[model samples]
Target chain A: MKKIIKPFWSYDVEQTEDWLQEMAEQGYILKKLHRASRTFYFEQAAPQNLSYRISFDRNQGPVLASRFLENGWTIAAASGKWQILQNSKPANEIKAAPVRQGVITHNRNVSFVFFGLLFYLLGVLLANLSTLVSSWLQDGTVAVEPSPLWAITYLFLALTLGAIGLAIYSIVKIKKSNQAMLQKESGIAAAKWKSSQPTLEIPESSGRFVKKAKLGWMYAPDRLESWLEKMEQQGYQLHHVGTIGTVFYFVKGEPRRMSYHAEYMSTVESSYFSIYEDAGWLKIFESWSAMEKWVIWCREYKEGEEKPRIYSEGSSHLKRARRMAGLYTVLFLPLLFIYAVNANREFQEFINEGAALSLFGLLPAIAFVLFLSFIYRMWAYYIRLRKNYSVFHR
Target chain B: MNADKVMKKYIPMTETAFYILLSLTEPRHGYGIVKHVEEISGTRLHLGSGTVYGTLTKMQKDGVITVFADEERKTLYEMTDLGKQLILAEIGRLKELHRNAVKYEGDFL
Candidate 1:
C-alpha cells in the first residue's frame, strides 16, 4: 500500500491568514511559517488558487495562496514575485535584521594581538634567562659549563626575529585604520555628487532610437554580468555602464541606481521603494515606469582621468594587511617561547659579563613592537566597522 | 521498474500513485523514478525534478518506502509492504470518492 505523503504548500499571497484559517477549518495543519516574509509551509489536501491574509501567533502578517496538483503542491518560483508581494496590500514586509556575528570578529582581533604579545614577551624572557645563566656559569655557581657563546647568540637571533615580526604586524594595523577613513570620506563625496546630479539625457541618433536601460548598483562585477545576461535575454539592452566600489550605474534614456547585494536582493528592492517614497518620486500609473525611476543615487563614471578606483583598491589592501599581520603574529609566538626555554649556558656566562647588552636590548624592543602590533589590530577593526557604518548609514 | 510485481501489496492504486510506486519498485533513484513514471504515464504528470526527490524522501520515512542497495551514491528507494498497503487503501478511498462524484445531477461539472 503506497501511503500518500502529503505535500506542504508554500506561497506568497495577499490573504495568507484567511487561507490558513480556511485550511485549518478543512483539517489542514500549518507546518512552518517564516516570520519575516509571512511565507509558510502547510500540510493539507491543497486547495485551489485561494489567497488570504493571515496573522501568525506573534501577530505578524503574511499573505498566502495555495493550490494542489495530482503530484503534490510545492513551491514553483520565488523570484521578483516574492518581494513584489509586500508592495500590494498590507504595506511593508517586517523581519528583524540578523544579529551581526561580532564575537568571531572580536576573537580574530584578540588572537592576532595575543599571539604577537606572547612571542615578544617569551623572546625577551629567554634573553634575560640566558644572560642570568651566563652570569651564574661565570661565577661557577651552576655546576656544568655553559654551552658555546654561538648557541646563546642563536637564541638571541630567534628572539630578534620574533620582535621584528611583531613590529611589522603593528605597522600594518595602523595603515589599515588610515585607509578605512580615506575610503569612507571618498564614499561620502561620491554620494553627494551623485545626489546633486540630474538624470542622463539620451543622446540623439539619426539612425535609430534605442530605449533599453540597465539601472542598478553593481556590487560584484562577475555577478552583475550574469544579471545583465538574464536581462538581455529578457530584451533589455545596455548603453553605458560604470562601477564605483560596490555601487554600479547603468544608463539608457534615464539613469537609476539600486543596491547590489547578492543574498539581500529582496531587502534592497524594498529599501529602494522606501527611498523612492521618501523622495516623492513614485508615479503609480506608469507602465514600465518601475524601470525608469531612480530609487537611490550613487556616482559611477565609466572613464575619468583619475577615478576613485584607487580608494577601493586601497581598501582591499588594508583588509589583506590586517589578515597577514594577524597570521604572522600567531606564527612568531611559539618560536620565541622555544628560544627562551633552550638558551645556551655559555651564552648565559657571556651575558653575565654584560657583553651581550646589545642583544639583550634588541630582544625586549622586538617584544614591545609585537605588543604594539596587537593593540593596532583592535584599532584597525574599530576603524573598519565605523567606516562601513558611516558609508551605509549616512 | 515493475510495479505490478513489487507493489502487489498496495494493489488498488491511482494511475499516478501506481506509476510513482512502480517506478520506485526497483532501486530507481528520484530521477530514475521520474523518467519511468513519465514513460508509463504517457508524459502527463511530468513531475518536476525537485518534486520527485521531495516525494521519495517523504515516502521512505513513512515506511511505505525503503532504500535499495547500490554502489552509486544516488539514494534509490523502493515501496515497502506497509507502503503498498497504504497505497491500496488510498486507491480504494479514491474509487469511492469517484463513485460519489459521478452521482451529481447538477451542471457543476
Candidate 2:
C-alpha cells in the first residue's frame, strides 16, 4: 500500500536519514524521496531492519553509482544532489570512510547561494527603508490602508522574512553537516529500521500555482528540478515557470519519472534547445533573474538508457564552476559597495543625531555584519573551488 | 615530465593519493582500485567512491595517471612513468623517515 507523510523541511542530512529509517522500521520502506515538497512516499512492506545512509554529490554519475553498488549499498532514493543508500548491515559495521569532496562542495555551494539571497533581501529592505520611514512619519504606521503599495510592502515583508529564515536554516544545516563529516562520522549515521502501520494523507488532485523564491542562482537548478519532480508525482506537471521564478504554474498529469536538468546561461538562443532536443531532451522552463539565467529541461528516463549530462567533460565542469564564481563575485561586489555607502550614510546620520541609537540605526549595523559574514563565506567557497580545480588547469 | 619537478610537486602526498597511485601500478577501474586499496591497507583505509573518482579525475588531469581503457561504463586507469617515479621518490622519503625513527625506537621502550 502507498502512503503519504506530512511534508518536512530539513537541511540536516543525518536527521533526514534518521526520519526515513524510522519510517522504514515502522514498515514504510521509502519508495521515492521528494525533497522539493519535503515529502516522502513509502510502500508498505513486512517490517525489516534496514540501515540508511546519505551522501551529497552534485554529480551522481554512473561510475559513482556503480561503485556504491559494488560496495553493497543499494540506491534507495535520490533527490537532487542527495543520494540515500541502504544496506542490511549496521552502518558502523561498514568501514569508516573519509568525507567526500563533493559534500564540501555541496555545502559551499549552498552557503554561497544563501549569501546571495540574504544580500538581495537586505537590499530590498534598505531601498524601502526611507519610504517606510516617510510613510510612518506621515501616518503612524508603515502599511496604512488598502492600497497596492501597502499590499506590496506587506507581501515583500512576508517573502523576505521567509527567505531570510530559510537562508539561516540552510546555513546552519550546512555547517552542522560539515562538522559531522569532518569528524569522520561517515557523513551520516545508519538509521535503525523498524516496522509499523502506514499513515495516510489525501493527495492534492487539482493543479495549483505556488509562489516560491530560492536564493543563489547556481544552487536553484537542483532544487527546482526536485520540486518539479515532487509536484509531478502529486499529479501536477509544471506547465510554466514565472518570469522571476517566484511563481510556478502547474497542470494535472500522471506520475512519471521525469528527468530534469537546469543549465546556466546568461542568454538563451533557439540553438541551445535544439541541441538538447536532438539528444532527446525537451525544454520545459526558463527563468532569468538578475543573478542567474537558467533553462530547465526534462526528459523521460527510458529503460536501459544512459542518463544524460549537461557537462560531460571535467574541464567543462570546472569552467562552469569558474563562470559561476565570477558571476557571484560580480553580483556580490556591487551589493557590498551599496552596503558600504549605506553604512557610511547611516553612521553620519546617527552622528548628526548626537550619537543616539534607534532601532532604525541598529538595523543597518546588523545588516552590515551579516553582509560581511556572507562575503567571507563566498570568498572561502571561491578559494576552495580554485584550490580543488587548480590541478585541472595544469 | 621532469622527475625532480614531479617529485617536488607531489612529495607530501595524501594517504588517499599515495594508495591510489600505488593501486594504479596495475591497470584498474574505479571500483577495482578501491577494493585493491582496501585490501592493501588491511581495511584501515576505506576509500569511498567519491574519493576514488575525484582522485582519478585529478590524477588524470595532472598527467600522473592515464586512462588505459574504457570497459563499457567503467574507465580503467594506469599510472604514468612520472607517477611511478613520484611513488619511488615518496618511498625513498619514507625510508629515510623510517631510518630516523629507528634511532629513537629504544627511547620509547
Candidate 3:
C-alpha cells in the first residue's frame, strides 16, 4: 500500500530523520520525498525498527551513493539539501569505527544559507530605507505618516525580525547538535554502516507524469540530486525544469542509475553546455534566483561505466569555493555600509528630535543587529574555506 | 623537493591521506582503494566514497598520484615519484619516533 503525508516541512535534519524512522517503525517505509508539495510517500512494509541518518552535501553523486550501498546503508529518501539513509541495525553495531558525517557540522554550507537569508533581509532593509527617506523629505520632518507606507514598513520590520530569530535558532541548534555528535550522544551518534542487507522493495512504477512545485535554496545541490535520483528510481525522468526551479515536470521512464551535477554560474555560454555534452552530460535544468544561477547536468551510467566530474581537479574545487566566498563578500560589504550609515542617521535624528521610540525608531537597532550577525557568519565562512583550501593546497 | 622538505610538508598527513597514498602504491580504482585501506587497517579506518574521491582528486592535482587507467566508471590511480619520496620520508620519521618510544618504554610504567 502507498500512503502520502502532506504539508510536512522540516528545517531541522535530526527531526526529519526521526520522523521518517518513526514512520518506518510503523511499517511505512519512505519511498520518495516531494519538496514542492512538502509531502512524503511511503510504501507499506512489515514494521521494522530502523535508524535514519541525514547527511548534507553540495556535490554528491552516484559514487557517494555507491559507497553507502557498499557499506550496507540504503538510501531511503532525499529532500531539500539532505540525503536520508536507513540502517536496519544500530549505528555502532554496524561499523567498528565511527563515521563522522553530520548534517549540522557542515559549517560552510550552513553559513552559505545564512548569508543568502542575510542578503534578502538586506534588500528589504534597503527598500524600506528609500521609502523612509522620500517620506521624510516630503514631510520636512521624521514624523509618523498616515499612509500605506506604515503597513509596508511594519511588514518589512516583522520579516527582518523573523529572519534574525530563525538564523539565531538555526545556528544554536546546529552547534548543539555538532557537540552532541562529537560526544557520541545517544540522540546524535555519527552515522555508521553495518553488514550488507537487502533494502526494502519499492512499489513498481505507475507510468504517469507528475508536476511538482518547489523552491530550490542555495547550497542545496545534494538534496536536489537525491530527489531527482529517487524519482528516476521510481521510473520517472525529469522532463523539464521551470525557470526558477520552483516547478519540476517529470515524465514516466524506466528506473535507472543516474548522476547529477549542479554548478553555479552567473553567465551561461554555449561552449559550457557543449563541453559537458561532449563528456556525455545532458543539460537537465537551469535555475536563476536572486543573483545566483545554477545549471544542473545529468548523465545515466550503466553499472560499470566510469563516473565523470564537471570539476576534476582539486584547484578547480578550491577556486569555486573562493569565487562563492568572494561573491558573498562583494554582495555583503555594500549592504553593510548602507545599513550602517542609515542606522547612524536615524539614531542622530531620534536624539536631536527627541522622537519617541516606536517600531520605526527601533529599525536602526534591528539593522545593526543583523549587520553584526552577517559579519560573524561571513567571517566563519571565510575561515572555513581558508582551512579547506589549506588542506587541499598541501 | 628534497627528502627533508618533503618530510616537513607531509609528516603529519591525515590518516585518510596517509592510507590513500599508501594504497596508491599499486594501481587501484576509487572503490578498490577504499577496500584496500579497510583490509590493511583491519577495519579500523573506514573511508567514505566522497572522502576518497575528493582526496584522490586533490592528490592528483598535487602531483602525488596519477591516473593509470580509466575503465568505464572506475579510474585507476598509482603513486608518482614525488608521492613515493614523501611516503619514504614519512616512514623514516615513523621509525625514528618508534626508536624514541622504545628507549623510553619503561619510563611510563
Candidate 4:
C-alpha cells in the first residue's frame, strides 16, 4: 500500500484524475481517499491503463446513466461532494460522460465565497488609504511610522489577499477545463497576435499609431464591438489596449472585414483564453477588473463567412443582461435612497421655514436624476436583449 | 400547472422535449428514457446522457413530471396530469401537421 498527500487536489479535479490514471499505469490503483481529501491510499496491482472522471453532485448522487455501468465504468472512490469513476477503456471510446455543468456550478459557487473575501479586503484597504490621505491633508502626518498593530493588520491583509487570490485562480482554472468538455467541435486554428498581453507600448516603426479613449465602453458591449469592427474596416487595425482598458491603439493597415466580440464573466479563468484562442478568435484585450471582467475578442473574416459567437445561445445573452441589470440596481439603490432623502430634507426646510434654497442643496436632486437614468438604462438594455430571445418561437 | 398554462409553455416544444415526455408515459429512469427514445425512433437519434439529464431536471421542475421512485441509485420519473395533457396537445398538433403535409405531398421534389 502507498499513501500520498495532495491537499489542493480538489482545486483541479481533471489533473487529479490524470494523476490517478498515471498511478494506475504504474501499478498503484487508488482504493480509498482520506476524509480530509488531502491523502490518497493505493494498493499494488498489475499495471493498467484506465480512464478516469471526477463528478460532483451536491444534494443527491451524481445523475449518470445506469448504462454507464454496463459500459464498464465503476465508482472507484467517493468522498464528500466528489466521486471518481474509472473504466477499462480510454476516454474517447466512452460515448456517455456525465454533464460537466454540475462541476462547473460547484466551482463557481466556491469562487463566489473567495470573491466576497477579496472584495472585503479591498474595501478595507481602500478605506485605510483614504483615511491616511485625509489625515495627512488636515494635520500633515503621513502615518509612515508603522505601529505594531498597523503592521500586523497590513501583513494579515496581504496574506489573506494572496491566499484568496490563489484560490480564485484555481477554481477558475478547473471550471474552464470542465467547460471545454461541455461541447466538442473541430478546433479552429488560433490566429497568433503580435502581443499576448495588451498594453500602451508600441514600436515607433510599426505604423502611424492612433490612440482612442473610450471610457465605460463595457456598459454597452455590442456598441463597443461594432465600433471596433468599423475601425478595422477603415484600415486602422487595433494594436492593443490601455492598462485599464480605457484606451485603444490602432495601427494603420489595409482595409479588411473583421468581427469583434466582447464577453463578460464573473471570474475569468486561464483556460478560458485558450478555448477562445483555439476557436480562431484573436484576443485584443482582457480588462483588469478584479471581480467582473470583460474580454475583447476579434477575428478577421470575409463578408459571407459565419460570424464567430462567444455567447452562442440567445437565452444566455438574456441571462447575462438580467444579471448585469440586477447587479447595478443593487449597487446603486442605497445611493439613490440617500440622495432622495437629502433632496426631500432640503425641500422641507425651504418650504416650512420660507428659507431660500442654497445652490449646494440642489446637488442631491441632480445626483438622484442621474442615478435614476442609469438604472433605467440598465433595464432598457435587458429588455433589448430579451426582445432577441425569440420568445414565441422557443 | 393547469392545462392551459402547460400547453402555452410547451405547445411549441423541441423534438427532444416531445420525445422525452412521450417516453415518460410509463415510469422510467434516466437510461431507460434514452433507450426507449432510441428504440421508438428506430435508432435515428442517439440522445446524449448529458442532454437527457438536463431535460429531465427542467421537466421535473415545471411540474410536467414527478419523481415516481428512488430505487437504489436511479430515480424513476412518471408523467403528471399536466404532462398527459401537454403530450396529448402536442400529439394533436403533430397530427394536424401530418395531415397538411400529406395533403400537399405533390409539392415535394
Candidate 5:
C-alpha cells in the first residue's frame, strides 16, 4: 500500500480525475481517502485501463452511489460528499456518468460559503487596521509587537486569504466545465423541431467572413444586439458566434431584416431553450457568465411580419434596463467610493508636495474613471431603452 | 407559507411553474417532474435538472411543497395546501386568459 498526501486535490476535479487514472494505469489503484489530511491510499494492482470520474453529491446519499453501481461503476474511494467512481470501460464508451447538476450546485454553494469567509476575513483585517490606527494616533511612531504570535497571526491571515482566492478560482473553473457540458446537453446543443423555428443557419458568403471583437459585450447587451441587427441590414449577416462569445463572425450577404436579443438569465432553468424556441427564436451564441447565462437569440422575419419579443409589449424591457442600472449602482457604489477617495488623496499629495505625478496615484484616477464610465453607460443604456419603449408605446 | 404571499408571487404563473405544480397531482421526485413535464408538453419543453432542483429548493423553503423519503429513500415531493391554493388561483387566471383569447380570436386572425 502507498499513501500520498495532496492538499486541496478536489479543487480541480478534472485534474484529480486524470491524476487518479494515471496512478491506476501504473498499477497503483486508489483504495481509500483521508478527508481531513488530504491523503490518498493506493493498493498495488495489475496495470489496466480505467476511467475515473470525480463527482460531488449535494445530498451525499446512497441514491447516487447505488445509481453509479447500477451503471457498472466501482466506488473506488469516498471522501465526505465527493466520490471517485471508476469504470472498466473507457469514458467514451460509458453510457452513464455522474450528473453535472450536483457538481454545479455544489460549486455554487461552496462559492457562497467562501464569500462569507472572505467577508469575515475582511472584517478581521479592518479590526486589525483600526487597532493599529488608534495606536498610531496615540503615539507619533509606529510600534511593533515582539511576540511570536504576531508572525503567526500574519501568516494565518495570508494563508486564509490564499485559500479563499483558490476557492473562488476553482469555482470559476467548475463553472466553465459545467458550461462546456451544458452545451452538449439535449436542448442547448440542438433546438428540437416541433415545427416552425428556423435552424441556426450560418450563411456562407464564399470566404467573406469578418470577425469582430466584442469584449465586455454583456455590459450593454441591448447595444450589441442592435449593432448586430444593423450589421444584418447592411448585408453583413452573422455567420456564427465565437466559442468564448466575445468575437462574432459575420458573413457579407444581401441586406436582410433580422432581430437580435441578448438575453441575460440570472439562473437558467431547464426548459429555457424550448419556450424561446417554441416562439421561433434561435440560439446564436451562449456564454456562462459569473454563474449566470447570457444567450444571444436571433430570428429573421419578412416585412409586415410581427417581430417576436420576450416582452411582447409595453415598458417591461425598459423596466428591466432600469433594474439592471439600479443593481450595478448598488454593487459598484462602494468600489467607486474607494477609488474616488484614493484618487482625491493622490491629487492632494501631488498638489501639496508639487512632486512629479506617480503611477500609484494615477492608477486610482484611471480606475475611478473606468468604473464611472461603466456606471454611466448603464444609466445611458437604461435611458435609451426607455426612449425606445416610449416610441413603441406611441 | 402564507397562501396570500404565494398567490401574489405566482399569479399568472410561468409555464414552467404551472407544469411543475400540475405534475404534483401525483407525488413525484425531482427528475420525475422534469420527465413528466416533457411528456405532458409533447417533448417540446426539456427542463434542466438545475432549474427543477432550484425551483424545488425554493418551494421547499417557502413551504409550498413538502417532501418525504420513499421506500427507496428518494425524496418524493408533493404540494401542500398553500401550493394547492396557489395553483388553483393560477388556473383561475389562466381560464380567464383562455376565455378572453377565445372571445377576441377574430380580430387577431
Candidate 6:
C-alpha cells in the first residue's frame, strides 16, 4: 500500500528566500543537490516508517514536489523546461550531488509615501500632545493662564509635517532601490532564459575574480587570505599587493600599489564598509579604483553579470542603524519630554503664576511618537528577515 | 498586572524588549517593535534581534505579550495588562530619573 502525492499548489513565491525558509521550518532536510537540473532533493521520514522525496527548484522559488509510491524514487527526462518533473522515471538513472549543510536560514524592507503619511499623522499627535501638556503644566492658575495649547499643538503639527516629509523621501529612496534590484533580477532572468541553448556549457574558472581590475574591493583582509588559499588550490597564483590600512589587497600575481589615501568616501553609501573603514581607504589608480569598484569589477568579470552581492550590505547597515535609532528614541523621548517640560524655565514661569498641571503629561506624547516609528520599522525588518531566511533555507 | 513580579529580579532589560513592551500600547512584531522603539525615543535607543528576542522571551515568560494572533508566520504581539503596568512603572521610574537629571545636570535630552 504505497502512495505518491503530487503538489497541491504552485505559484511564484514573492520572495525565494521566504519560501525556502518555510520549507526548512517544516523539517525538510536537503538529501541531494541535483546541480545539473538546478534542483535539490529533501528527505523527511513520514509519520509511518517510510521516507518521502521533496524536490525544490532553485530558480523557481520554493517549489516542493513530494512522492512516496512504489518506485524507489521517481525521475523524468531532463527536459530543461524549469518545470518540476511529475511523471515517474527511474532514480538510479539520475545522478545527484552530495548534500552540504551551511545555510541556516533566519533572515528578515521599506516604503516612503505610505509610511510618511503614517509617521506624519503620528508626529502630529505627538507634537500636539507634547506642547499641550507642556503648556498646561506651565500655567498654575486655570482662569488667568494662557492655555498655550494651540501654540503647542501647532508646533507639534509642524514637527509631524517634517517627519512625514522625511518619511516620504525615505520611502521613495527604498522603493527606488527595490525597483533597481527587481529590474536587475528580471534582466538576469531574461538573459538566462535567452541563453537557454542546450549546446552551452558553463566554463570552469578556478579563480575567484576573473577580472584583474576589480580585485581591490574583493580583497577583504579577514576572509580573503583563506579564500585566496582556496583559489591557490584551484591553481590561481595568489599575490600580495601590499596593505591599504586594514584591508590587504590580493591579485592573481604581484600587483603593486603606488599610493593609498585614507579619506572619507562620501559616495560609498554603505555604512558596513564605512564602519569597516574609520575613513574610506582609496587605493591609487591603475588596478582597484575603490573597494566598491573592485567588487563591481569582480562580480562582473568573474561572477558574470550576476549583480554583486556586497552592494546591498551597505544599505542593510544603514537600515539597521536607522531602526536602532528609531527604537531608542521611542523608549527615551517621553523621558526626554518630561525632563524638558520640568526644566524649561519658560514653562515653570507659567506654573509659578498659577495654572493646572498634569504630572509629566508631556512624557507619553514623546513615547507615542517613538512608538509609532518603532511599529513602522519593525514591520519593515521582520518582513525582510523572514523572507531572507526562507530563501537561504530553500 | 503583576508589577512586583517583574521588579522582583534585576533583569538586564534588553534595549529591544524593554523597548518592544515599551512600544506596545499597540501590536507589533519583530520590525514593527524595533521601529516603534526608535520613533518614540527620538533616535535614542536602537534594539537588534538579540535584544528583541530576549525581551520577547522574558516578557512572554512574565506574561507581558500574551499571544495575540499570527500575521503570516510572524507572531503579532500585544501588551498584556501586566506588561502595560510594567511599562507604566518604567515610565514613572524614568520620569523620576528625568526629574533628578533636570535638577542636577541642568539639561536633559
Q: Evaluate residue A201 in candidate 4 and report its C-alpha lDDT on the 0 to 100 scale.
A: 65
RMSD of 2: 23.0
TM-score comparison, 3 vs 5, better candidate: 5
User: Per-prediction DockQ, in order?
Assistant: 0.01, 0.02, 0.01, 0.07, 0.10, 0.01
- Reference-based lDDT, each prediction: 0.40, 0.61, 0.62, 0.70, 0.71, 0.40
The numbered model that scores best in DockQ is 5
Candidate 6 docking: what grade?
incorrect
lDDT of 2 by residue, B1-109 (tens): 4567667777898788889898877767565776788899997866643345556666765678765212121235777767888888898988998998998999999
* TM-score, every prediction: 0.23, 0.41, 0.37, 0.58, 0.56, 0.25
Q: Candidate 3 docking: what grade? A: incorrect
The weakest ten consecutive residues by lDDT in model 3 chain A span A186-195
Residues B29-89 of candidate 1: C-alpha lDDT, one tens digit per residue: 4556656776787867555332343344445544566652122212345566666666666
Q: Chain A only: give the TM-score of model 5.
A: 0.58
Residues A1-394, candidate 2, lDDT per residue (tens digit)? 4646544333556677777778788888987877777667788987767877666654344234343454457778777877777776666554322123455456657777998899898888887888888888997876656666877867878989999998887777776665554333211111111111112222334424443455543443455567766777777766666666556666565675677766566433222333344344555556634225676777666557655454433444455555665676676677777777877778897778677667776776677676666555555554654565676557
> Per candidate, chain B TM-score?
0.64, 0.88, 0.85, 0.90, 0.96, 0.76
**Poorest 10 consecutive residues by lDDT, candidate 6 chain A:** A99-108
Model 6, A23: alpha-carbon shift in Å?
A: 26
Candidate 6 Cα outliers beyond 4 Å, as residue runs: A1-394, B1-3, B10-16, B68-71, B104-109
Better of 4 and 6 by lDDT: 4
Identify the superior model by lDDT, candidate 2 or candidate 5.
Answer: 5
Off-target runs (Cα >4 Å) in candidate 5 are A1-103, A112-173, A180-207, A242-246, A291-293, A313-323, A357-361, A390-394, B10-81, B90-109
Better of 1 and 6 by TM-score: 6
Cα deviation at A375, candidate 6, in Å, is 41
Per-residue lDDT, model 5, residue A302, is 95
Kindly list the per-residue Cα lDDT of model 1 for residues A277-388, writing each as its tens digit: 2232221111111112222222233333322111122233334334444554565567655544434443575578765545664564566555555545544543664476
Compared with the true structure, what per-residue lDDT tens digits does model 3 show for residues A185-292?
A: 312111111112123233224435478876633344445677888888898877767777677777776797888776666433222333344344666676634237
Error of 2 at B76 (Å): 18
Across all candidates, the chain A TM-score values are 0.20, 0.44, 0.39, 0.61, 0.58, 0.19
Candidate 4: count of backbone clashes, pairs at least 3 residues apart or interchain? 0
